[model samples]
Target: MLTSKTRLLSLDAFRGFTIAAMFLVNNPGDWGSLYPQLEHAAWSGWTFTDCIFPFFLFIVGVSLHLSLHRKVLADHSETQLLLQLLKRALWIFLIGLALNLIPNFDFQSVRIPGVLQRIALCTALAAPLVVYSSWRGQLLVIMALLAIYSFIMLAVQVPDVEGNLVAAALEPGRDAGAYIDRSVFGNHLWKQSRTWDPEGLLSTLPAVCSVLFGVLTGHWLSAKRDIAEKTVWLFIAGLACLAIGQILASWLMPVNKSLWTPSFAVFMTGWALIVFACFYWLLDASPAIHLKNRMIYLMHPFIMYGMNALFLFTLSGLIAKMLGFIHLPQTDGSQPSLHALLYAPIKALPVSAVNASLLFALLFNLTMLIIAWGMWKKRWFVKV
Candidate 1:
């Protein structure tokens, strides 16, 4: 088994992979021509794009456990740790809000619910549970949160657009969560659909469960046991979660990403566990030293990307915004966004529209990778 001092290269690599995937999905040249897997599911069910946020949240949980456990072992005061977490979460949330402000900077219609904002909220909320709760307690909290959220989502009556009380439903912007968001956030909701946000407040409860599941996995990894045993059990547990989540999808709420349904939370945790277990086995737990070295070398790029994931995530968003914000004069005297201008040549390439779009995303990822490599070489880690 690895010592506490031994850095988990597998975790870093997994995080890096997730960040890279996020860039790929977020920066497609043509949003209109994306492959199905690159886009989120329309409403219910899920696609590969659905897995990214849950994976990041799971990584956050694991990282939180490992880091906080270290501080506790060193006899750090609880108040100090709590303050640190809050400070970090606050900065992240503000950064997310700033990103939402963008070129327009319109606070009136700015989106309050966002990916990083959700991450920040989840981190802040899960902090106490991670700091004070036992593994069993954390598990119970996850169960309770899921059950309570499921109950509220299914049973709560909400007012519709007409201000009439309506029974609980899961139809697009008509759901209870959406109604709550509309009522609370008002003009501050997601602009595309002002009535609801995928990252709305009520749905955040289950998202915390996603992070706590990772925390539990972190506990398992930190326990004194054979690394191989840990890997095996993690995979087994993941399979169990997967089965249970699938059953819940049919019996309770369908696997919906927008809702952050209980089934989606559990099912994605299963995926996170299974995927991370494979990485752990191959990169950390494997008995074959030569093979492990080769694997590590191959995954070093991801490690670099993961090291400064938050910075890269924020930077990527800003750059993407700028790309669309700046306009270029066109031949007909009309203006096209820099994004459109840059994409025109690529779209004109003798390739399929989807392939061209995919190429642009890959190129954008390459730019990010180069920056990551530079920062890695300089040891310039940007901590939140």
Candidate 2:
């Protein structure tokens, strides 16, 4: 029900940037030698890559808020809206589950908690709360969720490596979240580290706060304030949250993305707000600055990508899987996947291994861009 006039170009642009960044980071030709910024933190810290997933989740909240507002404006019944949102969430989660079964289709070790699954869960949990609560109530829910997660993480105890049930430690494998993941998923967690999964169950509780942060920002964006005034206040609010997050991290918890630590959530939320504010100021707030400028052309590809994000993300994943499935025998009588074959040449580039891997990812993103452009031209948008 959102018309052209109501649509926020800044939101779409930001979402597109996040999707594009995700594609680039995920599809790097060689994971072992990528740039540090592109790689996730080994355990406790964050890289630019760490921000990508949470940014997407936050965008989901914004999209959900806008969609629900449109539904309310259309006079849709709560039952109808609820059913629709539930169906969407379940379908997306199933898609995530199905993605894990790709060329191998091996269910025995398939990952349960994943990017799309997290999105589905966040949206499902946040939609009802947003619909039922006032803005003040939503703010309270955000605070309460963060507080409860912090307490549980700090106060709860589970057996450590020494066979003692004690308070959760801040280390990777020793944390309470890891214990829950191992208990529930058994051998079905992320294979990279059997001891823990980044998208585990307990960590997901704080991730919900990431979505709620977006929900609150969405509400603020749609408020009846003057555009410039809103932009200024958003900047101020973002800086304040950044300070608060830093203080909390320094005093109570380490800002860790894998844990989806409460401080990390607030910290990233601040970044998201500032980024959105900049986009709004440049693209939506000043019509002359946006439309009459040559720079507008640069925004076209990103906007197109945003228009059909879910489809592109899924297709990209499937294509990556298929590419890895096709194998060819090398001159040394060793079999290598198509991806390896393609990357082998890039590997010979007279540059750092990181730059070579980055080039491969850029090539993959270009291919996706072609598909996205085609979809945009045909006005075919696939949404979940």
Candidate 3:
């Protein structure tokens, strides 16, 4: 069994893989020319891109359980632990807000809801439960949150754009969550759709449950069980969650990432658990020393990326913004953004627009990987 003191290589690699995927989807050379799977589902379904955020949140849950549980066992004060988590959450939220303010420090119309912001909120909300609740209590909280969110989304009526009362509406800007976002954030919603924000307030209720799911998984892993048994049961639990999610999708709420529907949270948690189980079994739980060593060697780059995920995430967003903000003079006397200039060569290649865009994203990930490698070499880990 893996003890609390044993660092899980699998967790780091899984986190690294998710971060790399985030860079790929977020930094595509041409957002308009993306593979369907690379793009978020326009409405009430999911894509590979949609899985990344939930995966990261789930990892946060697992990490929270492992870390906080250890501290609690060590007789640390729960209040102090909570204070530290909230402080970290504040830093993360501020950084996310800072990213939105970049290139145009306009406080008037800047977005307040973002991926990092949502992560911060979820972490803060779940911190107390992880520190103070038992496994059963955490599970009950997850159920309660999901049920409450579903009820609000389905049973609550809200005013639509046309000033008509609509109930059970899941369309853009018409749902209860969207109404709450617009009412609360006003001009501070997502720029793409000012009527609604995907990472808005009410949706965060269910999002916190996503983290709780991961915490439960961590509880199971840290239990005094046989390694093989833990691996088998983890996979089974994931399957159970997947089944439940599908049932909910058909019977109640459809799986919508933007709304962060209960089905979506459960479904994505299932995927995260399954994926993490594979990693845990291969890297930490499995007794195959030679194969485990080989896998670790192969995944060194990801390990580096995972070591400084927050720093890399922030730095990458900053660089991407700069790439779009800075301009270069073109031959036709028209100035193009640095992003356009950099993508020009790849665009000229004899390839489909989608393929070219994918290539650029790959190159961007490689650049980040190189930076991660350097940071890893220098032992520079930026902790919040």
Candidate 4:
């Protein structure tokens, strides 16, 4: 029912929702003070905030399937299309690297693995398969990726601090993934957590499977099935995934976002599918025509944000960094960063620090909304 040029309103709305959540969670007025739901889980276990990154990656997989399928249908040569995908992936990775070097511009100690870099890597690896492989083949590849990652995590032995190569446990800074990252990138990893990188090379294997799961969902949506039938199947698949992921988590691995564990990938994919299916039903499948129209209108701001997701995401990161970089002198001779200065108004509110932080996040998202509205008005979309 959809075409290359025909915009899927539900997809846009879902993407917009994820982008808004990401901005709100990432740019709290105070990192030291945040609502528990807005912060990531300490090590393991899932939270509302933990869902944003995986949601974005899932959207990426869906977009890739639709876009690449469109290209194939249009008679684009496989060689030409692959080249374009590769170039886009390269640019995304370079942009992520450039963003890391901002403010300090410190090349020697810049973190190599990051959100955008991981997205780029996953896109580069998954795009070829999504474009070329059958649905069953893609499913097999997804299973293979997760299986490989699990084997490495459970079976690989790493030398401990004392230089004894023992089977690595899932401990902070000492996990198999962390050891591999330290070996590969050395000190050029997440400086805050020097011993490990959450988006490290080994962990990216499961992350790739996460995207592949999205590709599978996209292929299903694109199939010539009734809307109700599609929704039912998506629901069924989500439940099965959730059950499988839980079993894996309990027996073999833990569900960890940082590690991109196999169980985590499967669990989050289930969530992604259910959430997207809900959106599709509410926005696209509703029989009430007037109500559907009203719902679409109500979601205009989110649709605007969704349309220019990458641009807004990158711009927001830059703005947040610059705020940290610039500081103003205070009365006591101490300097407060721009972030603190902006937080002054919210800090004065008669609320708990966490509640005040939540207000600040809402205000920040309002600013993004205005910018997105302007872009929407002008039909300005910045594509990568």
TM-scores of the models, in the order given:
0.98, 0.95, 0.98, 0.97
Which stretches in model 3 have alpha-carbon errors above 4 Å? 1-4
- Clash totals in order: 0, 0, 0, 0
- Model 1 per-residue lDDT tens digits across residues 141-174: 9989999998888888888777767766888788
For model 1, what is the error of residue 285's alpha carbon versus the real structure, in angstroms, after optimal superposition? Answer: 1.0
Q: What is the C-alpha lDDT of each candidate?
A: 0.93, 0.84, 0.93, 0.87
Q: Evaluate model 3: give its TM-score.
A: 0.98
Colliding residue pairs in candidate 2: none
Q: What ranking of all candidate models by TM-score puts the best one first? A: 3, 1, 4, 2
In candidate 4, the residue pairs with backbone N, CA or C atoms under 3 Å apart (3 or more residues apart, or in different chains) clash, namely none
* Comparing 2 and 4 on lDDT, the stronger one: 4
TM-score of model number 1 = 0.98
Candidate 4 structure lDDT: 0.87
Error of 3 at 309 (Å): 0.7
